[model samples]
Target: MSAERVHRTTHDVTVAAPAGVVYGLISDAVQWPLYFPPNVHVEQLEFDGERERLRMWATANGEVKSWTSRRVLDAVARRVEFRQELPARPVRSMGGTWIVEPLGADRCKLTLLHDFTVDGDDPGAVAWVERATDTNSTAELANIKALAERWANLDELVLTFEDSVRVNGPAELVYDFLHRVADWPELVPHVSRLDVVEEEPGVQVMSMDTLTADGSSHTTESVRVCFPDAGRIVYKQTATPLLMSAHTGEWTVEQDETGATVVSRHSVVLREENIERVLGEGATVAAARRYVREALGRNSTATMNLAKSHAENAVTVL
Candidate 1:
């Protein structure tokens, strides 16, 4: 049999931050959805100090794809090497390395390298892989540069919080309520409009319009991955509100002695430049943070309450 053709590419950017900071960003795969635009979700399958396994979901040429990867991390050298254990379609094998070279005390060069082979070395498949790799690598590098440059304010720029409710019914019902988001417009008061499509089972692409306290609305598009057996759903917003640069969230339901507990978790990266434009002339980052926290908490809490009612009512009817 003939050997498959291999293609290689390299992408890099200069970051205005320390090599350690840049390396930290690349080493944490679980936080990719929050930092990188194309990533939808990442699950850590296993880790033993320097080596780890990850299951990742991301968009390739506007299509959602999932794969598992093994990665080796070297903090001292500021390098991470990764190989896809189970590459997605059109990709037979894929591997990459991230190298962070220190330029100065607060400057570094971040480089990403990729080498991959297509399933059958088909021209069309090779082209697709090339385009996807180029697009994703460009976006990832840009994101790292932007975030690393603002290392001083990252604490104020990034936020994470969650809200939960106790439900006196089955966990499945709660999962059902959240999974069927298309019905949210009718079931949830704050949701003005919602459209969802699932081209692949358990993977949803949705656009939603939600109302604020002042009667204004904002639209967001998101990709969601559902785990039925685990009673969890994870999502990342591709389109965000004016005040947010990025948003990712999770919905979880766990059964307990009494019934179940439903939780909604949210992580957001604030758009500092738009804070005053969105909230008024004198709005500060703290004010923006408070406003966002209240607004998201209210919406998630409302949904959780309704989900609780839906499950409890179903139990009552049965």
Candidate 2:
């Protein structure tokens, strides 16, 4: 047989970050390389003031593959559409969707749907493309989920805070008021300082200063904070050298027929760099879990009563 006809391949991923967060990150055009790595280059071409067209070049695993594609944003649907400008060896058509859906008050489900079409008259190559899509897609999704989860999880190094409070207020009102971190300094005691480094619609980077009992102070930089709506604010500590463990958590207000509870939950993971220094290689994962639990507890109840009160009062004022 001669050189086989070229074929297409498709891959996808389901991330844990809020769909809107994933969608915005994917659509930014500038941050694409940061997510996909060195193989891809993205450039912005035109802007209608709302959405812009992006040109992208992606290099496949080896020298045999390279192609350029143009993508447009469906901002209302929070999706990106791509069309190939120049076909390489096998890919006849390729495009995908990044989907975000609400799972509950504090969590969301992210899905990536990629489609591909193979070209040429050879029946074997086309069949190969069809057969490989499922396996490739599953692997792709796993990689995406790991990346998205890891990005948010890295923020836990220095600050990890989560707790639930029973406030005699409506959930929506409580959720709206908790979105502002500026009030945190005034309300939360150990939180001597809190400032917004920058704001982008629903997401922000917040800086915080905490005082120790010995009159010393510790400062953390670049906390990833996002306000999904009136009632939920999620934050993760940006990766830092000083942090051995990282955490990601959310603040959510829910009111059901029975009553409402303001729930705060966060997941913490260890950074491989600090694995040996903080917890020796032989240390059990259980020990790490306990450390995170205690750290979270410090920020709850007595430590976070002010935040609860702040949310309560905010409900009243609004």
Instruction: Provide TM-scores for the models.
Output: 0.98, 0.45
User: Pick by TM-score: which candidate is best?
Assistant: 1
Error of 1 at 78 (Å): 0.6
- Clash counts for the predictions, in order: 0, 10
Query: On residues 203-226, what C-alpha lDDT tens digit does candidate 2 reach at each position?
Result: 556677876445656675434334
lDDT of 2 at 79: 64
Number of colliding residue pairs in model 2:
10
Backbone clashes (count) for model 1: 0
Off by over 4 Å in 1: none
Give the per-residue lDDT digits (tens) of candidate 1, residues 37-109: 9999999999998999999999999999999999999999999999999999989999989999999999999
RMSD of 1: 1.1
